[model samples]
Target: MKHPSVIIFFLLSYVCCFAQEHTNKEVDSLYKEDQFYAGITYNLLGKIPEDVSQSGFSLGFHLGFIKDMPINKNRNVAIGLGLGFSANSYNQNLLINKDDLGNTTYTVIEDTGTYTKNKFSSHLIELPIEFRWRTSTATDYNFWRIYTGFKLGYVLTHRTKYIGDLGKIRYSNIEDFNNFQYGLTLSAGYNTWNLFLYYALNPIFSSDARLNGSEIDMNAVKIGLIFYIL
Candidate 1:
């Protein structure tokens, strides 16, 4: 769900029901200096034109390491910094193109069996920074947590593929693809299964990219399950 109410509801419920129980000493022991995170998310295009729509399921994966730095004596709150890899695929009816003049464009086309397996995928090297909070003791493996952060990603690879018609065709590392991306992220869970959300602040294509003479700007939104090991 795109609505923020869903996120607020869970967070508020968790805090109200459990946050008051932790003692100062117990909270102090909650933070771990190092953590590993993994996530599997469903991807969506947040602002695509009504005429253009997703055709198939889009899946995304993220794996990262974070080093936590306690900011208070209680250690229930901390800041995290880390590096990782991210990759995602989108199967949609929109197709990427270049006009005769070399201007990049996104065109909505019919799938009539002329082409199959149409999709676009990208991989990135990323740095994540987070502010974390939790209710836990040193020995507690299960805890309530709210982690919010931003991640900056540099494009590592990009590909577009189509199989059918004239034959299999693929484009790799298209010049019009955005090389840099940054997004806001949030994760909250009682234990290993966290609800994760990522909203990209940048568009998928360069500023100059257009469709039918209109600028084409599409940002990504992801929501799903995330796990953590500390």
Candidate 2:
């Protein structure tokens, strides 16, 4: 899930609530610090009609920061948020064919066509704010924490591109992604660092009969390290 937006919203709301309920000094003393981490991860995209080529993996890495605090007087649960960035894309080489009717659509070349790679890469701004429920508390030296939540964000780049038989092409906000950028993130790793999977409830790209559009699937799978400072 690309979640900077959701996390930011939740964080702002949390801060506002905190300011109304407790003193700034008390909030600072309890919140403590934040942590940062970076590592390699894979991006799995459902892909869009930019299908002038074949689709496959374009490797990348992710870097993130996290912060958390307890909820109310009950230390058993914590509210946390994180923001991260991942370099991701899809590469596809397709077979372009022109029909007698002047329609330029692609079909299998029966083992005779060549592969032209259509590559796309973008830096994702992610934010995940979570309400974590812990079963056990950590000692001074050991921290054992588990949490889950949702995230939301928009594609911050020309995240969609075409590099197949057609010349290089890029898309603006108009028809890119579902236009509703949000995904569900479930995670279980460790403190300041954990493995997570983000699932999108909406298609990254749109599907319509008009605009010469094709069905482009754009959900993704990401595995990376997470860190929380507080």
Candidate 3:
């Protein structure tokens, strides 16, 4: 027979192993979902001036991470704050030009057939704040969600390009563009497929940026899909 001390040591080791395994099997009661996200959108322009119109398909892409804070005990309702980046392009008949004297000009291209491509693109760093409601549980992966939020963005860079009969014209970091942009956003869906919409509350250009003596007060409207991942 073994000594009593040796037997006690074996018993203690077995108990410790069992406890460790049991702890590993236990699930976390406070789990969060959809903390990381990526999305793509179809961009549209609103409040266009006369003879100004969009042409080709304008696109926007976004990716972000949100800090999910559960408001209630169930963790189904939460507030989310996040930082993200977005790249957007608007393909339209509006032409932006700068002269040698550093003066900028905005023109409406009446003849769409003359230009093969005319577009302005912007890259932004964004801050998103959201009110989120979902039918999700800690163990459930598939659930319905509705998230509404406000997003504020600062332009990191912007460029305008035109390719057509006129010539290949390009401008970078136009000073006339509004450096800050804000919008309302909505995202709703089940599981992985979510519909996303964004409507800008302010114009893309400042009041000083004018077309034919009128302020080119155009806002952006985006509709598309957003995917969230754990």
Candidate 4:
């Protein structure tokens, strides 16, 4: 038989090794989820002028990274703050032109048949803040999620193009556009397919942009799908 001290040493060594392995498992369980995302949306105009109407497909593309901060032990509830980029286009009958004095003019095209292409596009850098809740665990890949948030964006570049009887009019960086845009956003769904919506809280154009002596206050609404990745 082995000496009594030798057996005690072996038993002590086994206990220490088991305890260390258990501690490593606990550390590994503290994990985070859903750090990256990408989405596409069908863009719409709201609160538009009486004569203005959408003609073509207006779409938006978005992608971003979010910092997720879980508040509870289960990690099912979290706050997310992210930086994103978005490119959006609005196709409508409202005309954007420049006068002789280099001033901007806004007009509604009564006859849609006159124009082949008329739209304005905007590129923005966005900040999104969300309150996130989900049926997610550290290791679960498929779960339900509901994320509601507010998004603020600053226009990086803007352009207007018209091709028709007007003989191809194009302009860039119109001063009438509001450089800062903000909105409310919601995203919810199960697993890979998620529904997303954004409703603008402010107008796309500044108050100086007027139509028929009234401020042309038009908001934006976006509906689409958003996908999240680990």
Query: Best candidate, lDDT-wise?
Result: 3
TM-score-better candidate, 1 vs 2: 1
- lDDT string for model 2 (1-230, tens) is 24533444454344434423422332323433333434445556544344233346555455566676777554657777778765555554433333578444433322223334455455567786777765434322124556677777656763445544445645444333453457776555544355666666676555531223445455565665444332
Judged by lDDT against the true structure, how good is candidate 1?
0.77
Q: How well does model 2 score by local distance difference test? A: 0.51
Q: What tens digits encode model 4's per-residue C-alpha lDDT throughout 1-230?
A: 02422443454344334423312234336666667777778899999888789998987877778898888999999999999888888899999999999999999999999989999998899999999999987656678999999999999989999999989999999999999999999999987678999999999999999999999889989999887765
Better of 1 and 3 by TM-score: 3
RMSD, each candidate, Å? 8.3, 9.2, 15.2, 16.5
lDDT of 4 at 12: 37
TM-score of each: 0.82, 0.59, 0.88, 0.87
Note the Cα lDDT for every prediction shown.
Answer: 0.77, 0.51, 0.86, 0.84
TM-score of 3: 0.88
Compute the lDDT of residue 206 as modeled in candidate 4: 97
lDDT of 3 by residue, 1-230 (tens): 02422443454344334422322234569988778777778999999898988988898877778999999999999999999888888999988988789899988888898989999999899999999999998767778999999999999988899999889999998888999999999999998778999999999999989998999999999999887876
Clashing pairs in 1: none
Model 1 weakest lDDT span, ten residues long: 1-10
